[model samples]
Target: MENISAAPETQIKETSFLSLNPSTLEVIGEVANTSREEIDDKIEKAQKAQKRWAARPDAERKEIILKVAEALQQNSKHLAAWITREQGKPLSGPGANFEMQACVGWTQVPASLDVPEEIVFEDETRKDILYRNPIGVVAAIAPWNWPLMIAIWQIIPSLRMGNAVVIKPSEYTTFCTQEMIKVINTVLPEDILQVITGRGEVGSYLTSHPEIGKIMFTGSIATGKKVIEASVKNMARLTLECGGNDAGIILPGFDVSKHIDQLFWAAFLNMGQTCACLKRLYVHENDYEKVVKALTDYSSHIPMGDGADEASILGPIQNKMQYDKILDLILDSEKNGADVLFRGQKPDLEGYFIPVTLIGNVDNGHRIVDEEQFGPVLPIIQYKTLEEAITKANNSENGLGASVWSDDLNEAQKVAAQLQAGTVWINQHGAIHPLVPFGGAKQSGYGVEFGIEGLKAVSLPKVISIKK
Candidate 1:
């Protein structure tokens, strides 16, 4: 049975922002846009609340994070439904349940972390200590893709370390994010964790606001640059995670049937909307044809339909602008002599459904290979040498994440070490843990998230010395 919701009527007059279910192109709900005055009020409140929050005992703060996790668990079903309705990620697979589980993990793991004071020096004559200090009010700008999960990654660490956070979720997925925040707020103090909703202008205002001490933003490279520009006026500490054209390489000798599913899904998770999803693939000549045929056969079985449908493993493109961009890239790739190895069916539906497309025999310089498509399209290139594959993978401006696949572990490890990305995976891609630190290199943006280092990213340090 198809577990899907029917489209709601198009009535957008009263809402400042209308959220559409990408699978059905139906209006999910209306959201209010924040004004400059309201933004000012929230910032001021956050500033005040941060001071009180920071003064609380570490035990008290930890308990609150745990409570928030419990609340999220209780409301998982409702939140998951909202996510599927607005974001178009199928509920059964990587949709709401997956996100909620991730959220719980992010919140609990960071809450459990303890950033103890570092004893720099200790002698009879003198003692030195370094401590992690909260950086007042933080403004977190989240993206449309993986809205709640990313927000949890941002907000939980900030709050756990005793800083108040003001979150600005993408307008595309605002309502569900607002609801997620609301659920957590039942366990948090007022203004300690607040939500601000609007378009880019609101984000610019918040980033530039003198009262906001730090900014954490996740989005496109173009917008990340703009965020850096706006934060300069306030000189706020910034942690920015921008775009990534992640690459995956298959070694010459690999079992195609055993690993093809991993290769295909890693590249197309969330319908290829994930920031660290493998956008490019390089296969050694010996394994090129075998890998192509295996991957094509694997993708044929995964159905694409409304996110609400339990049988649908993938959903529609989240928005029109991205849909058009993917189409442009595909047309350009065809013009550049790329051959199509596999193309999913083009459904007779109104929503923005682009079938999973794989173009083979492409070279590195092609736009399809160089740029971050951020859609359901991947370009697979054939390389004669491992060195050539490494060079081609590192050729792009982004170095967020990359992977090396091989049946031989030693050979895969040797090549994985050479890939110039923040995180390198062998036999897998984009799999991250809370205790491990993940960030970008090169133009992918700076500042790391996750682990004790991530807690320190949202905090400042103070050194104290005692002389005897």
Candidate 2:
């Protein structure tokens, strides 16, 4: 972390820290390094505000949330550009612009969803009704990757369920989230939605605050565990979407020529910074060479450069920490005699840029194949039988998502069913819909996000019984 400078030119104060563009290392701006005192004050205010906010009619809350979506639409271009600059995702393609659109769409979808009262049991003499109620103030901890979109994922559903939110964005990408919260606050009532920006300690304070009734977090497994510990003090309800080293399996009869492009993007979308992107690929020995060759050829033509350049579809690694980690993993793989099948050419520019790379002749035990690289590197593993592929794919501690690729839908569905993941796709990887529920399994953390279940996750269920 960079220290606050007294230099007048940078205008960085002791109370705030710099936000930089990862591709250029230029200062995007400074965001407040919120103190623990400020966090406690914000949480207290949010709790007071939540009472009035939750008391409003559900229809009125829905209307206000829809207005928030409209406000986001009006400021889409400005917000998207800021996101590209601060977060290091390209402005076009499935980058910052796409993420802004997703923010609006996610907000609208949650607003439209209905968590109606349910009649769980009914008889002539007695009846029971289940109701969903707001859990008061919610603490949202968002990750740097997909910062604005993931913040939206946390904020909208909490607000839709009538809970006040105080978001603590990743220090690496704070300005974009602060900017987004600024836009959203224009349409929301005072103190209903707030952003407390800082490093990890700020988040620790916010999560541990006793006034907070629930927590919604998306980040690494290690951090999620810390959050769980913090929540224990308040006994806060938690919805944690943690790390995922998702896998994709290619069946023996898969057509590499027809689906090669989709497969490449599935793994490399957002420069493979996504939590659920295909990290490990298991290919049947019969189609191993064809799958490798097709992916290499397709990736060779894609461009990598500054996020501002419209021609560049892929951008640099978002920060120095992740960039160095990816390089070390590649070096370690090479030291262990893994074959580097294809490495893309980097743009002749200075930045935290890493070329797109694909490794072959790697097995499950290898470090590169075992851990989540979370960058522009994919390791291809070869298997002899479907059972072997399934076993190797399910061998990881992280099981957020997985996919089975084949022309035969029936066989693909069967393979999908056998995989140990929260969401399994037939031919697509990391394609999520706002209406469908998505989360992780095993060490990837618990609780679901999106749709009605997501809304319920942020709310409490109360059963009412009436005897006749």
Candidate 3:
């Protein structure tokens, strides 16, 4: 309910965009501000479009994907500029480029890739066969933090697997996604790949809507559970890539300095607005003080707040609620006997900024360590043996990602395997490749994104039998 609408930008293109800013809560775009009835129309259009899209050959469907890639690169500068203006992230660098990187990730399907027919023969008499076919209409509700990339992560795979997609982006950053879709619609039929704009009500309408064949979402777990409950009417296939308070273990080694640098990037990249950011860190007690000292010294050099200029390392907290929740968690951690080592402080009211905070003596129950802070905050807790460290790492309900750092690759590998997470890192953190599948276990939610598994998430299996 902050009606933060602004006067439309002069000469803005016509689209179903929303009037919201990525950093400062100002309304500065030409947003359609579509109603629920209008969205209902788009859904109907998408349903009709899917019939033709599904009727097309798989290769033709894949061609549209490559066309999307070409359009993205040609419009990369425009996209990056839009991202910076909308999200307030670094415009010319890593932050601005991820949207393009994500677009390129799905440009082409793997050559020589075959989802072969799987044949199951129990006895000589009966045979069961399985192959893959496309699901009908996919309803994708993506988060705003990384609007273009997250949307691409959801949209591209679903589209590539031959399913028509209907995307509902977070209200805060719908402009960027709408811009992304604008480029793709040039080559793709508007009905096949469409984006609808609105708040939670719009998303709720889509989730429970009977026409959708499946729901793939990325956001907080609370909302994720709601989607699951709402999907029961049609038993829609669901994949929830929820939250993560991911942990990292740094072992004593000669190159611990390098590992500390890696941790700094992971802890504060995108202003620590990452799901798999290294939130909880455990260092060997012998070198614990040294690691903290090195991190604090290095961290001080990296500035925070409003990453509009290319030189700034971190940006604003995306929105106000996230800005406050970060401060609240730090306070709760302090109340729970956690020591505040290095706390980032910026009093500029214009920038919704939270400093890069590091906490010490964090336990299993502390909010700083237990839940996903989703900010530029790092907490350090000490542990003795490898088992104790692994025990602490696996104690959380989140199993999204974890890491171990040591000069000894074997030791790091050993610890990495022991951590109960989807992706593990050795000597590095947040190093991701598009070809690798990543997700979480326990309360971290389900389903894998990227790599071969990602392609399969939106694909349905079918069996054709040949009997003689």
Sort by TM-score, top down from the best: 2, 1, 3
Top model number, lDDT: 2
Which structure among the candidates has the greatest TM-score? 2
Clashing pairs in 3: 6-27, 131-462
Weakest ten-residue segment in model 3 by summed lDDT: 1-10
Pairing residues by index, what is the TM-score of model 2?
0.96
Model 2: per-residue lDDT, tens digit, 375-441? 9999999999999999999999998999999999998999999999999987889999999999999
Error of 3 at 173 (Å): 0.9
Q: Report lDDT per candidate.
A: 0.87, 0.89, 0.75
* Candidate 1 lDDT, 148-217, residue by residue in tens: 9999999999999989999988989898899899999999998898898876667777887888889998
| Alpha-carbon lDDT of model 3 | 0.75
Error of 3 at 322 (Å): 0.6
Q: On a 0 to 100 scale, what is the lDDT of residue 193 in model 1?
A: 88
TM-scores of the models, in the order given? 0.96, 0.96, 0.90
